[model samples]
Target: MQIILNGAATEVADALTMAELIEQLKLGGRRLAVEVNAELVPRSRFSEHRLAPQDQVEIIHAVGGG
Candidate 1:
């Protein structure tokens, strides 16, 4: 399957969930925010939010520095 990740075309496995995607990207356990097709996906729902082909995904990591 193909999805637009952070504005770039990328290939992923079929029936991939948000949580799995995070792990695949080596981003698990990090503080971040995820938006799919312009809709925000809460962390609690990452495991349940399944991504489909051509889905627009935006992943933003939180950085704390002052």
Candidate 2:
């Protein structure tokens, strides 16, 4: 399946869930926010949110400031 992740086109396995995607993206830290198709997805729901073709996923990571 094809989906747009963080403004890039990516091909992933069929029936991949958000949790899988997160791991694939190497976002194991807790300082990132995930938004799927314009909606904020909670961390607890990552495994339950299944991704479809052309799905838009925005992952934003936070940075420490002085």
lDDT of 2 at 53: 95
RMSD to native for every prediction?
0.5, 1.1
Candidate 2 local Cα displacement, residue 60, angstroms: 0.5
Best by lDDT: 1
Residue-level lDDT tens digits of model 2 in 1-66 = 998998999999988999998898788765888898999999889999999999998998889899
All candidates: TM-score: 0.97, 0.89
Q: Estimate every model's Cα lDDT from 0 to 1.
A: 0.98, 0.90
Worst 10 residues of 2 by lDDT: 24-33
Output the lDDT of residue 61, model 2.
Answer: 88
Model 2 local distance difference test score: 0.90
